[model samples]
Target: MEDPVNAMLCHHGFHPSMLAWCSMHQLNLGIMQDFSGSAILLLVRISFFGNYNAEDHLRESMKECTRRFKDFCKLHSFECSQCWLTTGMLHDNQTGWPSLKLKAYNARIFLMFVRAALQAAKSAREAQGLEEDAELSYAVMAAKALCSWFALVERAGRYLTPEQAAEQETAGLVFLRCYTFLARLAASQSIRRWHVITKFHGFRHILQSARLTLYNSRFLHTYVDEDFVGVWIRLSRRVAHALFEFRVLCRFLLRLQAMRTVDQRSVPARWS
Candidate 1:
């Protein structure tokens, strides 16, 4: 409704939309934290290694996967990170959303890959003279759902057309479906440690509210606020604590005032 914030909620807005700025970012952060202990990425990890919950095999698999990725990049001349997806994906990591993003990303087969695979599957089916949809592991679907979420956030805007809104809703449902899948899997596996947080459920509300409204939750993202807070933290550390809050406030305000006074005439003075 009004300047929809992260996860999007306003005083005038009813339920479903979460509190702006605080909730959605926290949801991402919260998911990141929980992922370290949960089965959220189990299927993706298993793709890297055949083992489940095998912490010992994680590094070996990561390095092996990274090596393969590097080789693939070199052979194809496609760009890739130096370390690939192995950095934050290690066991005992407190990785952020970026790392989790990497896991989700692995599921999004490139168009070329998808085409080739589909062609192969189609050939196999035709050869067999059967008409059944290609069977895929649930992991593939779940992982694709996460990728849809990433796509959703990347395309976030202040407003959306009806079609774009439908797309948004689709992405959100895909993501939520993955959550549901994981919840069910965890229950079946008796993974007692896994507990979904409120922010997780808040995402559904966010999507529902958005469908009713037109606010894009990712446009005015809260990450910049988080970064600004980091700057204040570094500045605060340099300031004497004698009048800590006051001193920090004055310094920040003065800096803002000085910048506000700068214009075209101030450029020469600035460089001079």
Candidate 2:
């Protein structure tokens, strides 16, 4: 294969739509790009002779990439962190990815974010002039949802049977990942009134579109055998849940906006 960096850049092509696609698919484009860069360097480190030196460097580099990716996600919002698991961050040495350990670490961060967001929301609500509680609440929900996702993934990893392990390594663990992302996003959106933001309309819409694409994709129909009925069902369920949550969020936002309009209009025209 080509250098990981080159491979990622080639695959993703530096486009916003590509980024959206990554998000829709629950891929971590930024972290994936980072690890692809690190993977190339890992190959170089492997060429050296000292076993300890190479291993040390590889571990450090891997952890560094993960830390940077996590930090980036925090900077942008936890939504992107949820994307990292399906993205490039998953490409590390299967035995050495430190997934359970990472999950524990992220869980702590997630709780911290939850507390901070709640505090901020309380402050905003008390301040009266600032209407930022919606956004803060969303951030908290995103962090909590991410923590829940990591817990699920860690559980899946810890409890995997031999057959499931083989399946994970092969066609990839699509159900767990896609489901986690959709569920997390839905939960966060519900908490944050994120659906109130017009720009985010496409977010839920894309998941709906992806469900149709995957269900009808020639690649799936051609490749997935009847024997894989279980996998098919799981994927279908994930898609359905995602779409259902999206609809609920849309309705909730519509009602909220309508109420806001009514409240604003109820006031008398004359000054108090």
The prediction achieving the highest lDDT against the true structure is 1
What C-alpha lDDT does candidate 1 achieve relative to the native structure?
Answer: 0.51
Clashing residue pair totals per candidate (backbone < 3 A): 2, 2
Residue-wise C-alpha lDDT for candidate 1, range 240-265, written one tens digit per residue: 98999999998877765765532332
- Relative to the true structure, candidate 2 reaches a TM of 0.21
Candidate 2 lDDT:
0.37
Candidate 1 Cα errors over 4 Å, as ranges: 1-18, 21-26, 32-47, 50-56, 65-136, 191-195, 233-272
Off by over 4 Å in 2: 1-132, 158-272
What's the TM-score of each model vs. the native? Answer: 0.52, 0.21
| Top of the candidates by TM-score | 1
- Candidate 2: Cα lDDT at 219: 19
Task: Please write out the lDDT profile of model 2 over residues 194-235, one tens digit for every residue.
Answer: 112222333343334334322111112212244345544454
Instruction: Give lDDT: candidate 2, residue 259.
Output: 48
> Residue 125 in model 1: shift from native, Å?
15
